[model samples]
Target chain A: MKTAKISNPSIVLQLDGLTKKIGGKAIVDGLSFDIAKGEVVGLLGPNGAGKTTTMRMIVGLIGMTSGDVRICGQSVRTNFEQAISHVGGIIENPEFYPYMTGYDNLMQYKRMTAGVTEARIAEVTRLVGMQDALGKRVKAYSLGMRQRLGIAQALLHEPKLLILDEPTNGLDPAGIREMREYLKQIAEAEGIAILVSSHLLSEIELMCSRIVVIQEGKLVTIRSLGESETPTQKLLSISLQVGNAERAQELINLMEDITIARADALTNRITLQLRQDQIPGLVGKLSTAGVEIYRIEEVRETLEEEFMKLTGGNRIA
Target chain B: MRNFTGLLVNEWLKLSKKRSFFVAYAILAVVFGILAYAFYELSPDGLNSTVDFATGTIMLQAAGQLVPVLAVLAAAGSVTQEHRYGTIKFLLIRAQSRNKILASKYIISVVYTLTLVLTAAVLAVVAGYIVYGGGAGESTWSDFLTNIASLAVYSIVFVTMTFMIGILTKSNGASIGVGIFSMMVGSLLVMLLSRYTITKYLLFSNTDLSVYNGEGPPIEGMTMAFSIVILLVYMALFLSVSFAVFKKRDIA
Candidate 1:
């Protein structure tokens, strides 16, 4: 609905020590992160881990107790209208006037957003594949239809930053996939920075290029899914087929920080977990001990396993 | 200023399409229609009533009753319904300031009340013509205008209080409860306290400006100018609190 020339083109949103306190207790504590253009970042936490609170602060639904959220280089506290003009978001569930038609609901938002043309309304509805349902009242819409309409309105403004809390809350597998595709497509084609939060680890793994994990209202870790390495995430899975699987595993027992994930006697195969930098040493020691190494390949750990390790097995709801 | 008008248009469209609001207007229409029939059938030859029957019916019908209830429902919905449907999350996040949004809702609620009044005024005139046969009891347009102006002042006073309740309670049931309770008991309190000096300063006692031109003040000393100042003071108090709280409070 509004456009401003970004002085900082790369970073669309910046959270500097964002914190929110209620009743003398902190709900979100010292959280900091940055989202760049054409990037999809996920906020992963337990059910009450302040993910929703952080999203609210960014979109100005909830006032921050201390710290600030800067969107497109404008401070939310000092310049709210200019800062929020570049954002489009749905905090939890996308709610609208149920008695009104979907088209009328969209028109309500359109009228408040300056410079939005009627043609853009058509374009957004088409983009969400909701042209047929536009005439029907919103009460008749299924949850999935409302989610799509939510996305349509968020994109109607052509915002520089998009924030969604649990974007795939009630969608079926296929619908979730469709939402992911739409988000990725919008991010790439329109240069929009997107932030989606969910408690489902595997869901975040499949959708986001990077994830910011928070537990107990504090930053735990930030990891990139794009082949970037961090010390805490250096664990790797190695599968090797040798002449004697048991003997090869026994030989690697002397190596520190090495453990067997699985072993097969019939096929002479052993699956080992170790650090990425220690792979060559493990293979060298196994081959020098009169063992024939037929094949070795690295297997990536499932993101669920990594998330569990990072969050320390907090119940994700 | 343009942004404020745009918000007003949005509120008007939403309220007009609302079933509850539309039903309120429908009831108003039916009530006026029935009252016209009753006035005609009960009197055989024309009563030749001196009062402007059209204007009198509007004030007597709406003084502290239907108009206030309808206006309160509409006003309360501006806050409570938004929270109920979870639409306030989206509304509060817009580029417009919360002050502007609150101001728009205030004006729209008043506009809604005035529109209801205008409809009843028109219907009352028709009823006046049909029952009186346009011979004697028919009011001059100026008298009709004066009565409408008086009703407008009363509407402002009632609506300001109702909207302030909406802001304070932030719950549909609670706002309606307080609005109804106050309007219902306002006159009773005034009557009971009429013997005391403090009754002259009571809000309800000063609200009925029609006392100046018609029945005179129930309290001995209240004048038209004094009532205007009192109304302005209360409006300022209610509106300042609304803007201050709305601008700073968390929407979550």
Candidate 2:
């Protein structure tokens, strides 16, 4: 195996035409992506969409039939030790020896990798907010706490890339929020590239800076979240409930910058596409036209909606 | 090399932390104690038997047979429990290669087996000294040394076989079942097949290295060197198959 040198410092993870086949059937075909440092990318796909398979391949937990994954310029196929040294991943669930204390679990990993000192372990434990529970056996830990300890173990070696598959699985609302905040903090604080796969679209939208959606073992799209505004982007969906639904529909249709996507006569609801800035003027025009608007709310395009549209109504979890 | 050592230490830590190992040792200790009391009470000459005989009998029962069973259980569980508990994922994603990981596990199983056998031998010697007043003279030392050496070799065979079973089956129950079956029925099969020329090279027939020290080989023509060679061959075969399958199979 030849050692690979890093020519590009910004890109922390690179997948080049990666493919896996079993029993003459392609599980992940020609899947490719690049994750840059300090960026959190969410991997979204429907059931059996090969998301887990892709993550496993990247981590070298499962062999790929063709192609390769490069972590910090080291090819996983040829230089496994060097490539994997730059990676920390939790495939499906974070599992540890339940009989061992959380600190011992972390120590087990620390021993496997070089330069992971006692101070580093302590620092990572504090980073994951698992300092208090370090001495407790893993069997006594909650799922959220175990997830934190898993992250701490992954971070012990200070890898350039961190891959978490469903990091927020089985967590309560508060636990989910805490995890999201911690992941964001870790990405920024450590400048580590994070690739997280999750079913929670709303959480993904909040947590990830970019979304890579795949379906049927293929890349569907890669969309950037919270990008700077550009010209010629004026479509926004705004839903309205008013007393005079027919008049509101006619008024919205007559407006210059707005077009009604859908209108219900019985429910007195209207969905209009217009510029976000034009909402106030549209509402004014509606009221001036004797349409009593009871509620006017922007129908934000959630990650779920975008994912559903891209996947053609396939359910993602 | 450092990472390999670390992996071995990690595996040892995991095995040591499990309550089952301690429980197994505790039970072994109690059984040794009870056997010592029985030897003391039931002696016709009232604890006048030679220490060699008492220690020899205890060592034969514990090291020769009982410790091998414990070693089998340990070896099987060392690999199978990782899969059963889904902790194999944790090890697979580490910076070390799969070969290193598997090698560490195999080495640890060997270490654990030796430790169990040695501990049982020590406990038996202690019980012999406590029950029977005579010290272990030169003859007893030779006997104990030879017996322990043979038991150690037997442990290697038993552990390697069961470790292969664990890797192939990836289940503790299945591996233990196969191990126990081989231990009980394997010798019987060897006896029934002894008339055939090929039975001289059979694994169970060659496992008892004690035959060299006047225990008598089940087959007449088999020598100690021949049995060692056969055991080594079987060990190589079992280990090669384990590593090949482990390296190729996907961790699901």
| Top model number, DockQ | 2
Off by over 4 Å in 2: A1-8, A228-233, A242-257, A265-267, A276-291, A315-317, B44-51, B58-63, B135-140
**Candidate No. with top lDDT:** 2
Residue-wise C-alpha lDDT for candidate 1, range A1-317, written one tens digit per residue = 32343446698898888999999889999998889998999998877888998999999888998988889888887788888889999888889899999999999888788988899999999998999999999999999999999998898878999999988888888888888899989998899999999766777887789999898789999989856554744787889999988888788888899898899989998888888788788878977898999898878777778877988887643
Candidate 2 on A89-170: residue-level lDDT in tens? 8876788899999989998999899889999998989888888899999999999898888888888899999999988888
Q: All candidates: CA RMSD in angstroms?
A: 4.4, 2.7
TM-score of chain B of 1: 0.91
| Clash pairs for candidate 2 | none
DockQ for all models: 0.66, 0.75
Error of 2 at A39 (Å): 1.3
Per-residue C-alpha lDDT of model 2 across residues B89-154, encoded as one tens digit per residue: 888887888888889999998998888777777777787778766643435567667888888887
